[model samples]
Every structure is written in structure tokens, then in C-alpha cells.
Target: ALYYYADNPQRPYDPEKAKQMLSAAGVSNLTLKYLIRAGDEVDEQTAVLVQQQLAQAGITANLQKVDPSQEWDMTIAGDYDISVNYWTNDILDPDQKTTFVLGHDSNNNYMTNYKNDAVKDLVAKARLELDPKKREQMYIDLQKMAKDDVNWIDLYYSPYINVARKNIDNFHQNPLGRFFLEDTVKN
Candidate 1:
């Protein structure tokens, strides 16, 4: 809902306002098709929550749960109206997080089909920038533009989990979610 409305974090959620907006737009009893990938409890539960929220505004969300493999293809092909899926920006660099997913020519840009010259330029410049401050500002602006554009819904944040035995030594995982197995020694 926040993503769809480009909501500001400072403002609280107002279902009545949303209902009024829908009513004003003559959107009562509107039905929208929603997609959810199979096999993930988080994704499934989130979709249901979204459905319930939209109902408050007199919108009916019909959810279709499909195989995880088919979900991407359907999104890329623009066959879905709305889809609840998970993505990981595992890399430490924001460039990897944004560019690979939101770049104009990005392979993973199927959901929004987003192509913004400013965003592309900022991402490009940020990649080559050596100054941390400059790079950080560029990424900040890029994210702000993306949110304003309502590219996608920002759902719950899930932490990455990895387990190892006590005997294991030098076990480390990069921010990119890569496991350093070569340096790991087991007693």
C-alpha cells in the first residue's frame, strides 16, 4: 500500500483516506488480479494481508499462486497485474543492489519496466565514484526517485540466516551473502 501510494514514512497509515480516494475515483468494487509465488510462507502471507487491506477500500484482490519458476516468466512477460515476490540485494555496494535490479537494461527489471535516464545516470556515476559521501548521496537520490515513481511495493524485511557448527573455524559470510568456504576449517 505504501509503495502504491508513494507514502511518506513519517505519515501514519490511514485507511479511511484510502477509501475516500477510491470512492472519489469511482473505483468501488474494483477487482484486481494478484500473483504470488508458491512455496514461500512469507510471500503467501503478505499477499493475503495485502488482499485484506485493499478490501477496506472496496477493492477485491484475486490472488493466483503459481510455481516459483513460472512467476518470473509471467512478470517478465507482463502477464501479471500485481505480484508478491522476494528479491535480495545481497552485495555490500549499493550499485549492485540498485543497478543490477533497476538499471535501464537490467535483466531483472521485468516487474516495473522502469527506465529513467536520471536514475541510470546516477547509478553509473555512483559506481565510479571513490568518495563515500558522494556515492552515498547519489544512491539516496536514486532510491528517492524510485520510491516516488512507485516502482514496487516495499514489503517486510527478512534477514539472511546461515548456520555453522562450533568446530568450524574462520567461518565468514560477506555482505553479498557469499560464504567463505575456502578459509573455513572444521575440527
Candidate 2:
């Protein structure tokens, strides 16, 4: 879970501003149907949270509880305006990230139905840059392309909370945001 920040730091959430933008774009009466998996605990919680927030923004949000597989199919088909999901993103390279975000991949369920050329081009350039600094800049460009297109509206970055038995020793969490049981032993 991560919040998608725009390229410009000054741009903050302004509902009125959003209304104007949508209005200028000739978009109105936009009822966003939000699809979320039924049985998953985290998904249920996230769906409720998102529903509340979207309601406050005056976007009519309807929540649909569906089976997880069907949920993905629906999202992939661009059937809904919004979807609540949990992702385990493997942060590799910029290209790897785009595989979901830019193209037709499982990760990108934005339903924008846009094939952005700039996003794809920038990601390819980033991948070719062996220099870390150059690569970083390319990634920055790629991100802005994503933001400008509004490919995904990220909500929050989440950390895992773990509860272990008292007897477990050396149960340290890893930087990858998960607990490791490698050195752990029962007392």
C-alpha cells in the first residue's frame, strides 16, 4: 500500500479543484462502482475505508462484494470505476514496475483504458540507463507520466504488524516489510 504522489510537491488534495478539473473535462454524474473481494479481511477493511472517503468527495460509490477470481476478471475487463486490493509488489527495476502500471498487467486495474506512449517510452529509457543517477531521473519522468494520466490513485503505504508467541526467540522483521523466521527458535 502506497500513496501516489504527483511530480509537483505543491499539488495537494483539493476536492473543489478536482470538481473544476472534472467539469472542464466535461465529466459529470460520475458514479464510481467500487469492487472488492468478499472474504478477505484486509480487502473488506480497505473497501469500507475507501467507500467512506469517496462518499465525502461526492462521488457516488457503490461497493460490490465478489469472489476474488471474478473480482480480478471484473477489474481486468475495466468493469468498475474503482477496486480495493492488496498488492505484493516486487520492486525490481523501472521496467518491472511498468509491466503492471503502464501496460495490460494484473497490477494495473485503474480501468482508465488508456495506452500511454510516454509512460512506456520513459520506462524503457530508464531501463537502459546503467548509471544510477540517470536511471533515477528517468524513473522520476516515468512517475510523472503516471500521475499526469492518473493511472492509479495510491492511498497509503502499509507496514505489516506481527504478533508472535512469547517463547519465540530471534524473530526479527526484515527490511522487505515482513518477518523472517530464519534464526527464530522456540524457547
Candidate 3:
């Protein structure tokens, strides 16, 4: 799990501030269509919570449960104002998360459609950077930039758990949710 960085900005939940911002922007009775994948209990529950939160901010969110098969296409095509989804990187590298999800030229970007030249340059530099310190700094900068840009609101990270019997030897669980039983043995 990624821990919080010291320099990361804090955005406290303030429904009043959200209301004021909407009023300043001349937006009233604003309603957003929130797309959720059907059969996902977590997504449905999150949508309900988000709807209540948005209502407190004077904004309306209409939740629409969509089939799993069509969820990807709908989100990629920008058919919904907001979509509920989760992403888990296969490896513990910032490359896939940063470039594929936030980069402008990437085709895997859901509906964010966020485009920034600075972000693009930073992602490219971080990928090829040979210096560890430089790469880390670049990623830090990218995180701050992405947060400021409000690319997406991160709710929380779910933990993965693995259970096994006592006799199972060499049974290890991968943090990335992969299982390799080739070396595992039951004594």
C-alpha cells in the first residue's frame, strides 16, 4: 500500500466550501450521472455515499448501475459524468499507474481525459531516469501535480488477504494479489 507523502496537500471534506464553489461558478441544481458496475456491492454502496455527500454540497448525483461488459466502453467513451472502478497494478512501479492512467497519449485512460504537457514530460522523464533520487523526485512532483489537477478522487485502498492451512509450507502471498504455488508444499 502507498503511504501518504509528507508534502502531499490535504483536502479536507468541506461540503460548505463545495457549495460555495458551485455558487461562485453560477452552477445550481447541477445533477451528475454516476455510473456503477452492476453486481459490485462495494461500488453500489460507494455510489450511495457519494450521492449523499454531493447532496450535502448542493449537487445531485444520479446513480446508474451498468453491466460489467459495458462498463469499460461506457467509461472510456465518456458516457458518464462519474464512474466507479478500481485499479491494481501488477507490479509495484509508478510507471504503469502514472503513464497509462494519467498520460494524455495513453489509450487506457478511463474518462478522466486529463491533458497536461507538464505531466506528460514528467512521466516520460521518470520512466527513463537512471538516477534513483531523480526518479523519486519526479514521481513526487507528479503526485503533487496530479492532486492539484484533481484528476480523480481517491477514496480508499482495499486490503488483500490470503488464508492457508498450518501444514502448508513455503506458502507465500503476493501483495499484488498474485499466487505462485510451484514452490509450495504441504507437509
State which candidate has the highest lDDT. 3
Would you list the clashing residue pairs of candidate 2?
1-156, 1-157, 2-156
| Local accuracy of candidate 3 as per-residue lDDT tens digits, 1-187 | 3322477777888999999999999999999999999999989999999899989998899998889878888888888898877888898888878888777765645468887789888888888998878888888888898889988887888888778899998876688888888999999
What lDDT is reached at residue 54 by model 2? 58
- Please give, for residues 139-161, the per-residue lDDT of candidate 1 as tens digits: 77777887777677667666668
What's the CA error at residue 43 for candidate 3, in Å?
0.7
51-114 per-residue lDDT for model 2 (tens digits): 7765665667788999989987898787887886544556534466565667544444244565
The residue ranges of model 3 lying beyond 4 angstroms of the native Cα positions read 1-4
TM-score for all models, in order of appearance: 0.79, 0.78, 0.91
| Model 3: how far residue 121 lies from native, Å | 1.3
- Model 2 residue runs over 4 Å out of place are 1-11, 91-95, 103-114, 177-179
Q: Give the TM-score of candidate 1.
A: 0.79
Which residue segments of model 1 deviate by more than 4 Å?
Answer: 1-12, 106-110, 128-132
- RMSD to native, candidate 3: 1.9
Whichever of 2 and 3 has more TM-score, that candidate is: 3
**For residue 155, what is the lDDT in candidate 2?**
69
What's the lDDT for candidate 3? Answer: 0.83
